[model samples]
Target: MFKTLSRKTVYQNRWMKLHEDIIERPGGIEGLFGVVEKPDFSAIIAVDNGHIHLVEQYRYPIGQRSLELPMGGWPEQPDADPLALARGELQEETGYVAEHIEQIGYHHVDNGGGTMGCNVFFATGLTFSGRNPDPEEADLEPMTLPLTEFERRIKDGEILDACTIACYGLAKLKGLV
Candidate 1:
């Protein structure tokens, strides 16, 4: 097993940190591992009457307004329950209160470099709730497409967000939504 000898923070912010670890490899060789430490986020598949709610927003890093599931986390509160985060994101991004929010599964944000991951939830029985998006999501637009269309978009490479696609796939495979 890889054993950590020491860890040093290389960079840090409200959302995440980069750390470098001095390690002993399984075969006893010494090496280093660079890791991004981030709090877990949550994604919600909000479904109602054969449709799914989606939010379109500009993602700064990619410089594109992309359609994706409602997702977010309380970065400053990493210990907070992911289920609560999912419910809040569903409400904040879509203005839809879910009468039932069930966690479907979890997925890593990026297995190669980051320890961050997300919990996926299947939300049902949505009711109108006033939008109160986070400042970062001020331009978010909430809409519903048929669930079949959402699947088509995924198969066509239209939905590029990894977490959104992974979480939705899990919900479908697990028969949660």
Candidate 2:
């Protein structure tokens, strides 16, 4: 296993911290590694009947709006409950609350370069009220599509978010979907 010889925080913000590390490789050679440290997030798959709710919003870093499952994290509250985050994000982004939320699985975001993982939840029996999006997510639009259509979108490359794909796949694999 590679050993961390030294690590230094190069930058930090509310959302993430960037670190530079010197590592002793398996062959005993020294090398540098850059990592982004961030708190985990939760992704929710809200399904009611045959429909699944999703959020579409402009992802600034990617310079385009993308479709994804309701997801968010509280970097300020890293130890926050995963189910709470999942529930809140679903209602905040999609204006839907699930009568039941089941944690399907967890996945690392970028094991090679980031210290972040996400908890995935399978939600059923949704009820829509109204959205409570944050200012940054003011433009988010939510849509409910047939579960089969949602899966087709993923297969057709219309849904490109890795977390969303991974979460939904895990749920489906576990026979929750």
Candidate 3:
């Protein structure tokens, strides 16, 4: 185990904060460590008929459009349940509400540094509703694709979000997708 010697705030921003630390490792080596603690998030894999619901958005930082499941973090509502967050995000991003929602799993997105984890949910019996997307989420558009086509997109690297992929992969492995 590594023991933290000292910790200092390296950066602080509205969305996320970072900490730098001096640590003594179990191997008796002293080194610097960086940690980023962001709020936990939730994502939904909503399936209706034989199609999977996804959102297409232009990610400014990546300068490309990404196809990902409905996902969001509620930093201000940290105490809120992840299932509620999942339901809210699904409706906000995709305008779909599911009668059945099951917790698939959680994933550490960047275990090396970031403390961001995403709770994955499997949503079924979906019903459509009007979307109330956030202004910051202007580029998002909800789309449904056939399960086969979605899997093809993933295999073709068209779907690159790790959390989304991990969730679907686990769902498939467990024969839940």
Candidate 1, residues 1-177, lDDT tens digits: the string is 889999999999999899999999888999988999988888899999999999999999999989999988897788889888888888888999999988878888888889988888899999997889888777999989998899999999999988888888788788866
Expressed as tens digits, the lDDT of each residue in 18-64 for candidate 3 is: 99999999999999989998988898989988899999999889999
Clashes of 2: 0
Give the poorly placed runs of model 1, Cα more than 4 Å off: none
Report the CA-based lDDT of candidate 2 relative to the real structure. 0.91
The per-residue C-alpha lDDT of model 3 at residue 167 equals 88
Maximum-lDDT candidate: 2
Could you give candidate 2's per-residue lDDT for residues 1-177 as a string of tens digits? 999999999999889999999999999999999999999999998888888899999999999999999999976788889999999889999998889998878889999999899999999988888889999888899988999999999999999999889888888888877
TM-score of 1: 0.94
Off by over 4 Å in 3: none
The deviation in Å at residue 28 for candidate 3 is 1.7
The all-Cα superposition gives candidate 2 an RMSD in Å to the true structure of 1.0
Candidates ranked by TM-score, best first?
A: 2, 3, 1
